[model samples]
Target: MTAELLEFLEELSRALIASGNSVTDTERILWSVAESQGVEVEVSVLPTMIIIKAEGEVSRMGLAAQSPGMMPLHQVTEIYRLTDDVTSRRMEVGEALGELRGI
Candidate 1:
């Protein structure tokens, strides 16, 4: 299921590029689709990048195993939000450092 989802995002990315759509416009379209599909995405914009995450209230979202009785952290990074569009992408210097350290 995840592989299929990744493939779908890749194709969607390609189509967005082919259509000459800007990232901002793409995000708007993406939000519209997500709303209809019952997925919630929160966009955090940096100077030249955007981070997408699933929406949760002030409570009820986290990392960890997510088993019925598992406890998760309150930290944001550990939580993951699925991305439906891959056309919008960026990497961070801190993440690069973590990769360098084999984290």
Candidate 2:
């Protein structure tokens, strides 16, 4: 699972850069985010990004634009955290997303 996650992160990082996006400090942030989710493995840092794979069961998280997309990690992270059985580390994704005013 860790291997798959790192691989995906590396690929996603490349894709993000190819499309022109700054990933500065993203590795740490992503690791935190992943832990916030239910990903129990360590997020290994690749050349450009961090990787952590989904384990056991994988859920198709969709996007919020209602464009027929899978739910994004940000949306399901808290649920994952809850699933991980940690009751005190919840992050209100909806609230945080609501604060993204101009983006």
The TM-scores of all predictions, comma-separated, are 0.35, 0.32
Q: Once superposed on the true structure, which residue ranges of model 1 sit more than 4 Å away at CA? A: 1-10, 44-51, 56-103
Evaluated at residue 40, the lDDT of candidate 1 is: 64
Evaluate model 2: give its TM-score: 0.32
Local accuracy of candidate 2 as per-residue lDDT tens digits, 7-44: 33444333333333345543454455456644654444
Could you tally the backbone clashes for each prediction? 0, 6
* Candidate 1 positional error at 60, Å: 20
Which pairs of residues collide in candidate 1?
none
